[model samples]
Each structure stands twice: as C-alpha cells, then as structure tokens.
Target: MTVSPSLSLAQRLRLWVSRPAGPPAKAVQFDRALTPWAFLVPQLAIVVIFFYWPSAQAVTSSFYLEDPFGFGATFVGLDNYADLSRSNEYRQIAGFTAFFSAVVTALALGLGLLLAVKADKVIRAAGPYKTALISVYAIAPPVAALIGMMLFDLHIGPATQFAALFGYDLRVGIDYWDTAFALIVISVWKQVPYNFIFFLSGLQSVPVSVREAALIDARSGWRRFVDVTLPLLAPTAFFLLIINVTYALFDTFGIIDVIVKDKPANNPMTLVYKVYLDGFKGNDIGGSSAQSVVLMVLVAVLTVVQFRLLERRVHYG
Candidate 1:
C-alpha cells in the first residue's frame, strides 16, 4: 500500500482517485427471509390459539350433542339448530337484538357526532373537555355498569331522587322500560367516547377553507353543514356504524351482566348474553354453540350488508 516518493503530487492524487471504494463498503442487505417471520411467530401463535382455535371449536361443537360432563359427545346433525328454528323464545330474542342494536348504533353515533361538533367549535380549553369526555372510555365496563347501577338503584339512588324532584319515579329494576333505558344508557356511554375520537379526527381532516367557502356561499350554517361538512363525514359515519353494531352485539357483554338484575327476564337479554346463559349457566353446550354460530352468522351478514349498502353513499375526503 506504499506510494512512491518519486511520483509527483498530481500523480499521487490521480492514483488515489483511480483506486476503488473498497468492496462497495459491503452494502448491507436487509433481504433476510426469516427475520420478519421470526418477529411475527408470537403474534401468529396467539391469534391461532386464542381466536381461530375457539372459533373452530365452537363451530365443531355446534354440530354435535355434547354431554354435560366433558366426555361424551354425539353427532346430532342439525337438531340443535332445528330446535332453535322452532323456538318462539329464540325469535323474540332475535327481535330484541335487532331493536337494541339499531338503537345503540343510532344513539352512539348521533350523540358522539354532536359532541364532536361542539368540541370542534370550542375556542378555549379544549383539552379539559376532551379529557373529561375520554375519561368515560377508560371506565371499565363492569365499573361503569356498577356506577350506573348505584346512580339508578331503586331505594337510594340520586337519579331516582332527582326524578322524584320532577314528580316521576325512576326505578331501575322494577320497571321494564326503565331497565331497558339504563342498558341503553350504559351502551351509549361506552360508545360515545370511541365515536367522539373518530368523528373528531374526521372533522379535523376537513379543510377550514371548505368550511369557510360553504359558510360564505350558503345562506345558513345548517345548509352548509348538510351540503358540505356532513357529506365529507359520511365515510366516518359509515365506519362508526359498523363498529357500533358490532359493539352492540358483542362488546356489551359485561355491561349487560352488571346492569341486569334478572338474567332470566326477557327485558335485557341479547343474543351474546343468551349464549352465555345457555352454555355456561345452563350447560346446554350444543344448543349454545349453535346459538353462537347463528349470532356469528348474523354479525357477519350485518357487516357485509352495511359495507355494501352504505359504502356507496360514503364520501371519502
């Protein structure tokens, strides 16, 4: 590697320039096939074990008659589903489910969007408003239910006392509609924060110039919102509709458990709760599995229908 002292400075410079950059600095290759997969193994295993395995077992168990004890299982073809098809109670449960899901989705999305709009309009101290709103989301389902329970407890609840002040008795458990209202309140309470976050994010994405232009050209604020802002929010609204439906179906399990004093009563039972009531509580494993399968189908169908039908109307901003 020694250079000749006899060579001129220009010659030395030329020689140095002519030398290669030493094996291209061993260009690092990130094309390893196994590294990405090595990272994904744990997640894949967890999904398979927790989600797919149980789903498969539920499907399999739905097709057979399982003994109360874990040992004996007999293939019952479609009898469990057949019994469900003929049951008047199952039909009523389905009806209640449809109504409850629709109401929850509407209340959650509507109130959330309204709250988000008001929050968006706030010119001062928005942090406190958002924090207060989101604190409800952090409340655990059982805890939230318990709080609602205490608030509406028949004998010693502030809510009942507040109603008494208005000359109306608001008993939580003793009245069917009152109980229904409480469940709806809890369901809506849990969903509003989630919907608020999404809707606020959506609203913030709308350009201020668009709002300004709408306001300048349109006669009124309501007209501008209807023509411009609401259309742009259609996609967000539609997305939330799907989530709210799924939440109504499945995610309200704990809320229902804590809120309903009478599980056997028809007032507050959804399909998800019915599955638990039948399977774990009643030990009708086969029938409950079938019911679970039916619920799974219903949810899948509902999602598909909403996406297909509503996506056509959505305006992506």
Candidate 2:
C-alpha cells in the first residue's frame, strides 16, 4: 500500500518490529551524527541550568565576599575558606556533621539489613509486606520530616508519650545531644526504607543454589547467613552506606530545621545546616559558599576512598 515519506528509518524499523501491517520499506534515512545530540540537548540543557550553572556560581561566589542581597561582590581570594577553617563554630559544626552522619548511616544500614533479611524469609504474602515496608521511601523528605516532628512532639506526640512511659523522652528542645539524637533517629528512619529496598533486591539476586549449598555445609542458620548471605550483600551495603551518609549530610536539613524550630539554641548543628544558617539567616554569603565547597570536596574524597579501599571486598555475584 502507501508508505509515509516522512517516516525515518529508525521509526519505520520500530513500527515494523511491533506490527506486520506497518509502513512499506520505503523509509527516509536521516542523518545520524546529530540525532543522538538532538535527543540529548533537552536533558543537557536542563542539567546545565539546574546543576552546572548553580555550581559554577557557588564556586565563583566562594572566592568573593558578598552580602545576602546578591550585590557588592569583592574578590577576596581564599579568605572565606581560610576564615571558615579557623572558626571554632565551624569546627563544632564539622564534629556534629561527622557524628550525625555516622550514627544515621550505621542505624539505617543495620536496620535495613535486618528488615531485608526478615522480609526475604517471609514465604506468604511477601509481595504485600515488602511493598508496605518500602512505601515510606515514597514520601517526600520534607513531609517525612514533618511526620517525624509530629511523632516526637513533646506535648502532643504519641511516640513521645510512649517513650516517656519507658522513662525516655525523644522530643525536641531538651539538650544539644538529645536534639541531635532525635534528628539522627528521624534521619535513620527516613533512610531505612530506601536502604531496605536495595538490600532486599540484592538479597533476592543471590543465587539460591549457592545459599542451599551453604545450608548443606553449615548447620546453623546464622552461620550460613554470615558466611554466604552477608558477603553477597556487601556491594549493596556499600552503595547504601554512601547514600545514607549523603542523606544525613545534606537531605536531613528539613528534619533538623523542623526540630530546631528556626533557632538552633546551642544545638549540635551540622555543617550543611550551618551553611544554610550562615548564608540565608546570618547573611554571610562568602562563608556559606566556602562551606558548600568544603562539603563538595569532602564527599568527593570519601567517594574516592570507598572506590579504592572498600570496594575490594564487594562480591558482584
């Protein structure tokens, strides 16, 4: 019958593969060199606009002393970074960030592994239960923070009341460590569902034959798990370690903000939170920009270390 002269060769091939009653073989061949870039242009533009441009601005701003009003930029050339390095408050912020990230990563990874193992063991209604467990990850970060705040509210919180009965208060506005601890718990809870999704997928990918062989050799279930299952899950655990640390470092700002109620009040504020406070609230643009640069460098260094040192133990299969 009649063929569409406008149809490109790739489009015609796709149509032919899907249906026999497709257009005739007379398809127009288009230039290939620019086709790939034509498809990529939209996405590349978005990335440049949203990511690269802002990053370049931050890098440039870090070298300048500016105000919150986005005017009167004077090039200071490393003075911002030098001042940040010498500040006691900045050092305290770094300590807070380290402790918070460590605790959140450990708790999230540990709980995720435990939950994934348990979920894997479920033979009945496994799909529904696993879906339910992972559904929390679908919640937005700010919304999750709100939920966490509500749950641990000192006066009206159910979890707080429940904890009070056990002689433990998990509410805010208590002590510096207490606030930090509550924030850590919220961060871990928010991260666990994501980590659980990955760990469960990794556990399911482990060859059943290998597990059965381990079962035949090891009499104890825990022993078989430690020897066979844990090793196999190492790659997944490593990935989640990086993600959890990132979430604790950057994404937990919402939860920290909610808990602090706008005033940190001598609380253990993280480096990321300090960046926000200094730049937005305190109106010290140069300091915040420098902090952002430091954070970027720290993450890059840690990622390199993970690839170099920790990745050797990862079992792909």
Candidate 3:
C-alpha cells in the first residue's frame, strides 16, 4: 500500500522536528549531565595525585636503584626483590609480622565475638556496656600506644608492678618476646572494641522472628546460636575478619613502633614497619617499595579469598 503524499510529508516533518533541537540537544541531559563529573573531578584528581600517582611511582621504583645523588634511578630488574628475599632480616621480620598478625587477628575476633554475644543478651545496662566497649575504639591509636607503653614499660608501668606481685621479673625497656606479646595484647585491645561494634551491630540486625522461630523449634542457647544466629552473622563476621586482619597487618605498625622501635629485628614488627625502616631509616627505597608491593599482593589475595569463601554464605536482606 502506497502512503498518501500529504501523510508522507507530515511523517517526515514530525521525524525532523523530533530529532532533538540544537542547544537543547546538548543541554544538560541526564546521560550527558556535567554536574556529577563536576562534583567528581576534584575527588578524582585528589585520588590520582595521592593514591594512584604514588602507587605507580612505587611500582616503578621497585625495579630500580637510586644513585647517591638521588637524581637518577637505574633499572635493576627485580634485583631489589631478590636481595630482599635473600636478606635474613627480611625473612625474620616477615615471619614475626605473620605470626603477630595471625595471633592478634584470632584473639581480637574471638574476644569480640564473645563480647558481642554477651552484650546482646544484656538484662540491664547494655547500653553502658556497649558504650564502654566501643569507647576504646574511639581512642586514637597513638594515644592508645602511649597509654600501653606507659602501662607496660618495665621501669615504672603498672604491668610491671602487677607482674612483680606474681613473682615474675618483668622489666620493660624492650624485651623481644615481651614486647612482641605486649604489641599483640595492645593490638587485640584496640581492635576487639572495633570488631565488637561491628559484631554487635550484626547480631542486633538479625531478625528477632527468626530467632524466636528457632526457639519454638526447641533450639536452645548453643544450638540456636550455632545453627541460626551464626549463619545470620556470617557476613558481619567475614567483614570483621578482613578488617581485623588488615588492621593487624598494617595499622598496628605505629603501635608496634612506639612499643618496640629499638627491637625491629626481634619484636612484632610488621611488613609495613619494615618497609618504613628500609625506606626512611636504612635508605633502601627499592627494597621498601618491593616489600610494599608484596604486602599489597598479600592483602589482595586474602581479601579475594574472604569474598570467595563468604559470598555464598552471606544472606542479604
């Protein structure tokens, strides 16, 4: 069927008009909106400058050697990494870091879980308990470290006084084993409060009805907790696991440094602390950059593993 000439012309005109008009065509449209980009540009620039740029520079520096003048960097092609691996100091520091991280993460998570569960069952003054528990987390790490140092320092700390009562000679300048244990203790002390907050939030977020249903089915206390409540808290548990592990690895370095600066080769010095020592103290920029890369890889792997294992178990609301 052939269209009438008038109808054909009318259709053509409609199509032509509907084909967006000039300035209106480019006018702040949703898909072409500039506001979001305008808002994002500053943040993007900051990230590029602070995070991406430095990260890129570090990666490049990892493969190079710096001359005495610091003007020219020579390509070393993984020599820094090879030297790092061969260094007994690197192995010892890494081993200490790993052991400390593992122990502190485990203790923090365990104690946090216990506290969260106990707080969740509060018959009275739960709010006070929660506030007190979480208050530790609000304290600055440096302040906390100073307090710990004051408390545990062998010469005048309360811990030394307490240990003396137990007939234990605990002098606190810097004992390798003692400092390592103190670092772990202080780490757990700081981290447990943070983890408790998350765990408590997670526990409270679990549906009351589901827990009641479990009780109706004669699932009491431990069984109900294991079978019902635990699965619900899995996502929170996984999150805290990752966060606590990362904190134990990276954030605790400052605390360790304050508590064990003189004992870098012995105490619970982490990979981050080692990197700082190499780059700033020892002037081994290449070695530090390589260690930083290794640490990034380690964290990335652990994060990926956490998601892989817990993704299926997490129940999204």
Candidate 4:
C-alpha cells in the first residue's frame, strides 16, 4: 500500500513489456501470406461461375421437365431417371458406352505405350515421330471424324476397296458390327497418338541409371522393361488411363455422332450420344439431363476408384 514511486514505475514498465503488442498475436506476415489469394481469386471465381455453376444447373435440370423454351421447368422428381432405366434404348446405349470406353482406353494405352517405347529408342528421328503423332491429335475431332467416315464408310470408302483387294467385301455401312468396329478403330487412332505423348514423357523421365543397372543385373530387354520401366511409368499410365477413358466417353461423341447418327443399331452410339439425341432430336430435355447425370456419376465413380486403388501404386518423383 505504501509502495515507492520508483518501484511502482519499474513494475508498470515490466507489465508494459510483458503485454502483447497490437491485436491478439496475428500470424507472422499475414499480408504476405494472403497475397497469393488476390491472384487466385479470379481463377477461383471463373471455375465457380463456368464449371461448377453449369454442373449445378445440369444436376438441377435433371429433376425437372422444362418447357420447350426452357423458361419454365416443372419438377418431375425421378420420373426421367425411371424412364431411362425402363427404356431399351437407354440400356443399349449404356452398354455400348461402357464397352466403347473400355475397349478404346485399353487399345489407346497399349498402343501408346508401344509407340512411346519405340520412339524413345529413336535418338535421331524422335522429333519427327512425335510431330507426326501429335499432329493427328492436334487436328479437330470433327475433321478427324469426317476423314474417318470417308475412309471407312461402305459405298465409296477406301477401306472397302482395300478389303476387296484382299478378296473380302467389307461393307461397313450394311454391317452393324463392322460399323461398330470401324468406330473403335477411329477412336483408337485418334486417341493413341495423344496418349503416346504422355507415355513418351513418362518414359523419358525414367532414370537412365536405373535402366543401366537393370541391364547390368543380367536382366533381358523384356524383363527390364517389365520390371523397371513399367513400375516407373505407373503414375503416368494411371493418369493417362483416366484421361483417355474420360475422353473416349465424352469427347468421342463428336466422331460417333457424325458416323453413327443414322445407325442407332450400331454399338458406337454411346450414352453421351443418347443424351445428345434425346435433347436435340427427341426434344426430351429432362431425359437428356438424366442421362447426363448418369454419365457424370459413372465418370465420378471411375475417377474415385482410380485415385483410391491406383494412387498407392503410382511412383511420382
């Protein structure tokens, strides 16, 4: 109670020194840490507005039956989905879509890996090979489709003439199965080149020392590739696998639409094509939206499965 002024002043100074400065202990350099957000905000907004907003609209639209003008859509609950399930066309389309995606993915990946491996060995002409391969990929899908149709279509298509030269009348137009196969061929041709680029990059990224070590260990070419190269390329393969599958499902629609619009019986008319036909030709917006939702769900499930199962095995540097 009778403290000296000097002692009191010293105690006050100690308390002032102990006190936290400014606002409650903020993060160190808060402004600097958050500065990246200024740059990120525009991209984030774009993604939300264009990608997420449209996806949300598509999902929402699936539950409603829209008027012809799309101004007023009446909520239909699950009727559109129910109809899709009951329809034979939808079942056929789904089956074809699954088959086409699976076949094309496998073919593209296999061929791409092969091509990439061969190209990797070519120290002299690697650039030319890559250029030729990627050039096909750079062409517009519609243009590719048109060219594919011209090459394979029944009447005046060269594929038919080539078949004749081999004493086989390969009429793609008349034969549903042949047409389906042609679609597969076209799909594989267009995608294999694109997939090759990724595979090539992955191959190139593999350490030369590891490969040399494998060779020194008396590993044959096939064994070395199987044991070492494949393991190293697992991540790239998995990535391309998912991407190629998605492309086969979605982007290949343009080619399929061009070639098989009239031939509904052909197996190339996949789920996306069904959605397009439903929305535009059949004028069934709700049904198309439901089909799209189903396709989206399928893709989502596949993507999740890829991450869950394949991610552990992938070797990323």
RMSD to the true structure for each prediction, in A, is 15.7, 9.9, 13.6, 15.2
Please provide, for model 3 over 1-317, each residue's C-alpha lDDT reduced to its tens digit, 9 standing for 90 to 100: 11322222223333556577545655565764788799899999999999999899889989999864588888999999899889988888888877988898899999999989998888275799888987898886667888999999777889888989999877544567777777878889998988788788888877779868988875468988888888888767766666676787778867977887565654557788888988988787888899889887876566556555655577755
lDDT head-to-head 1 vs 3, winner: 1
The runs of at least 3 residues in candidate 3 whose Cα sits more than 4 Å from the true structure, single-residue gaps closed, are: 1-29, 33-36, 68-71, 262-265, 313-317
TM-score of each: 0.85, 0.84, 0.84, 0.81
lDDT of 4 at 45: 100
Per-residue lDDT over 13-115 for candidate 4, one digit per residue giving the tens place of the 0 to 100 score: 3355557675656566455777879989999999999999988887888999988776888999998889988998778777877888899999999999999
Rank order (by lDDT, best first): 1, 2, 4, 3
Which candidate leads the pack in TM-score?
1
Off by over 4 Å in 1: 1-37, 165-168
Residue 226 local lDDT, model 1: 86
Give per-residue CA lDDT, model 2, range 200-279, as digits (tens).
88889888798789979999989988989998888777666766777788788888887786667587778888988988
In model 4, which residue pairs have backbone atoms overlapping below 3 Å? none
Q: 1 or 3, which is superior by TM-score? A: 1
For the record, the alpha-carbon RMSD of candidate 2 to the native fold, in angstroms, is 9.9
lDDT of each: 0.81, 0.79, 0.78, 0.79
lDDT of prediction 3: 0.78
Name the candidate, 1 or 4, with the larger TM-score value: 1
